[model samples]
Target: MRAPTPVSASLDDLEPGDQALVAEVSPPHELSAWTAWLTSLGFEPGEPVRLLSRARPGGDPLCVRVGGSTYALRRAEAACIRVWREVARR
Candidate 1:
């Protein structure tokens, strides 16, 4: 059988413990200021990334691991990063 196609989605869509690869960083028009900063944080295309967890009460800030660093990003900020979901290996 042919392998399944990979799905692309915003980083915020990843569940805790899920992993994905950085696909693109396209912040909305108003949030465009963060594009360069996010890329500097290793959110560039093809980097490995993982969703660590979400804040309680409201899942506003999401903890994510990119490259060798960990960062807490607001949901809106996380949404600026597009990612390709990584399938778990057996």
Candidate 2:
């Protein structure tokens, strides 16, 4: 099987309307906080996340909807977030 390509941009770099699947947590610690938060919202690792909107001026926080719940994440933490392009939903 072929290995998946790595997503290089921070979560803050994702534009509104974009969707991606969590490929892996880069650096691991980057996702520590996010993982806990997402779990409470039913968003598990490898789930799809839709970029719902941008938050704040400098793009420090991003609004993403995952598993029917919306979440706000910081840019620094998002930098370590890795993802793959989300395929079409069946």
For all predicted structures, in order, the TM-scores are 0.90, 0.62
Please identify model 1 stretches exceeding 4 Å from their true place. 1-4, 87-90
Question: Candidate 2 local accuracy as lDDT?
Answer: 0.64
TM-score (C-alpha, index-matched) for candidate 1: 0.90
Alpha carbon lDDT of each predicted model: 0.92, 0.64
User: CA shift at 65, candidate 2, in angstroms?
Assistant: 1.2
Tens digit of per-residue lDDT, candidate 1, span 1-90: 456467899999999998899999999898888999999999999999999999997998999999999999999999999999845443
Every model's Cα RMSD, please?
A: 2.7, 5.8
- lDDT string for model 2 (16-73, tens) is 8988876545546644766665456544567787778776687658777777677776
